[model samples]
Target: MFTIGLTDHLEGPPDRPSGEIFGEVADLVQLADRLGVRYAWFSEHHAHAHQGHLPTPLLLALHLAGQTQRIRLGTAIICLNLHHPLDVAEQVAVADVLTTGRMAVGFGSGSTPEESALFGSVVADDRERQTRFSEALRVIRSAWSGDWSGNVPHAFSVPPHRTLPVPAADLPGRCWVAVNSLGSARIAGDLGFNILFSHLRTPEQYRDYCAAYRAAGGEGLVAANRPVFVGPDDATAFARAEPALRTLWRRFRQEGKIPAETTEPANPEDLCGHPINFIVGGPETVARKLCELHEQSPFDVANVEVRWAGLSHERVCDSLRRLMEDVVPRIANAKSLTGRMPR
Candidate 1:
């Protein structure tokens, strides 16, 4: 089965009250759930108004869980290095219980130096933070299974009592790591978790990640989180969406150089050879783009990002309906499963 989900960043002006965003998100999620979208993934970040307003995604997800049934709710990632892992374990466990086994989590070493500094010296550096994140997985799983030994890091003491909302047996297939490299993909696969990739990376990068993941015996499918905009036609769609895409370009424009050909774009129209990843088109074109993406990367799911990229509420809703009634049926027939991993 293939899965399609909606992911939003709640990116808006900081002055926008949290309640307004929450209500909008509830509506969006309800629409997605009713339309048979398999999962609703939310991102977690703190100290950044532009990236997302919701610092506590699990809380919002829990609220969403109350409003809908059957759709899987997830944190695309909760930065593990910044917070005590046990605190996260508690939150996820509660979310799991409330959602009745529908809670999926993605963990990451903190991403930026600025975000890292918010946590003081606990994170150390990228390598050290990654190490801590690696240890955190073990600690969290140990808490899940009611096992007290082996994986707990020495920095923290184990809880004497069994954690409530003990994880379901199939959690290995539910949790994920947001991967950007072959190495990270292999690590996630070796550790027995699903994987997430972003629109910024090329399909070739996805190919490398998937190959290494499969080499390491990964069972769960690789999923892509992409920004998508749809309209009545390609021109209208691109014209309406380019401004937001440009903003995204500037947002992701960072100090990094990797593959020589894929350097950051000089202008908004420059897609860095990844137009399909941005997903601007009519229904037919969008459907075709998804197929093309699957051809190269074989991703079983696409956690499509809307709203945050500045599409109007009306347009976002209309596009979502199009994705549901038009785009999805052409792509896959997957329904919301209780906890089954997409094949």
Candidate 2:
């Protein structure tokens, strides 16, 4: 059956204590666990003007581990090419142990050049980035399995013992790769990792990518992230979302990062006009659209990014609660129009 989850985005600056946000997020995860949401994925970003916070998702996961019991915690997409593979392995291994084996590591060749520069990453060509990422994944998986034969020294090794924690036998799984372009999707398919397509393309594109992955013998969960906000009234939801949505688009346009042919709004208020840009509606509307998308694709998880630019934290949380209460149960329990939900 399909499950629902949230992708955490801790906005603002890194100097600000994440603990402030963590309190709220902890509450959200607790609610999600009670609501039967399967995963809570946190993203890693850096060196952005708007407080490019959350430098370490693994740390956040560790903190959440103390607060949550059943819901899986993960790095939505940890730019694996940035750090030494051994370091990544050690950190994730500890998180897995802390959470009692409830961890999913999602990796990607990050999109923004600014972030790459900040991390002192090589900024290699896409092919090379993919190659390095694949190699790192191998190293990380080997380290986690405690069966490494390579001469690579453990970065945090003790005199006679390695410091890394060994994950329990029931560890949820290894890393998932976030695929935006078709090339990455194909690589993810061939390599057999979980896939996360975070609203980077249309539903049709996602379906095609999923088909390719399955055809290539890839397995494990396939998930997507979509921006969704549900409220008691559609007008209130849209009104509340206007400012943040505008700011997000403005920043993207000023940076020349807007997708091809996607025009910048003359005013931030008009940002919602961009079709399929964001999902704003009440329960039934949101549920129908989610079910339709699932019917058309093979998504085992649907992660809704409920937090956006203009909406207040309270509003975002309320929207998510409503979604969990109204939308998720309907979609999770109902059979897809085609047949049973994708497992």
Candidate 3:
């Protein structure tokens, strides 16, 4: 099956009440659950008030688990280098127990210098950060198996004792590693973790990342994250999502994430020509784009972002409905006819 998943950074304006944002996310996940979305992923970001504000994904997953019946809840990533691996292992284990083993986790090295400073674990560079991340992940997996014994500096340290609240037996099967580099992808594969590719990458990049993962013996899922918004038709979808997309682009521009030479997109055509390829259209259009992506990269799951930059709760819910109820069936049909789905 061409499985589809949902991911959210819990983005909202600073002025918006946190409760409203969380409530809306809960509603979206519940909607997806009822509509048979395979997974619901939440991201973690610290002190990010207006954007990427959901700092505790496991907590949110536990909360959502009580509300929804079937959708598997996961951390799109937890910045493992910033916190104790033992603590994370404990929380993940508890979540598995309470959610009846419907929990998943994606671990990554922490990003941004400010976050590292705040966490009191400032790494010298990406290499050091990844080293720390590798160590932390090993400790976490060891703790899950109750066989932990290592003391990596600035990563983790403990005496000869098993961490409390052992994880579910199948928890490691659900572990993922968020990766932007081939080295990280290989590491994720070599360590028996699934791969979560960055949304910013192109299809060619996805192919290369998948190749690296497979070369390193990765046999688990390969998830590609992308912003997706579907509506009744192409024009309606573009019009509805463009404003929020503009808001997102402007913020990224201000943060130096977008090139200054790039102009704000005026319409769907402009968006198609822009650097970021957001999947914005009606059901058929969205479905076609996703199929094209799969044909190019051959991934296992489409981890989509349906909400962005102050987009309304109602609009998001509608998009999720169209995506799951409409777009997904089209993909499945295409796969059946063309045999394009990854084996």
Clash totals in order:
0, 4, 0
Compose the digit string of candidate 3's lDDT tens values, residues 47-76: 773376688988998999999998889898
lDDT (Cα, tens digit) per residue for candidate 2, span 1-343: 5778778766754565767666767787787777777788888877643454677888887787777778778888787867877788788888887676788778877746777777676688878776676677666666776655554434323233344577764442456888876667777777668889876477888877777777877776788778888877667766777677777676666656576567666643366443335677778777877887777776778877776656777887788888989887777666654432433
Model 2: worst 10 consecutive residues (lDDT sum): 152-161
Off by over 4 Å in 1: 122-126, 155-161, 253-276, 333-343
The TM-score leader among the candidates is: 3
TM-score of model 1 relative to the true fold?
Answer: 0.87
Q: Please provide the root mean square deviation of candidate 1 (C-alpha atoms, Å).
A: 4.1
Stretches of candidate 2 exceeding 4 Å from the true structure: 13-19, 49-51, 151-164, 169-174, 259-276, 337-343
Pitting candidate 1 against candidate 2, the one with the higher lDDT is: 1
Error of model 3, residue 311, in angstroms? 2.1
Q: What overall lDDT, based on C-alpha atoms, would model 2 receive against the true structure?
A: 0.72
Ranked candidates, highest TM-score first: 3, 1, 2
Error of 3 at 54 (Å): 1.9
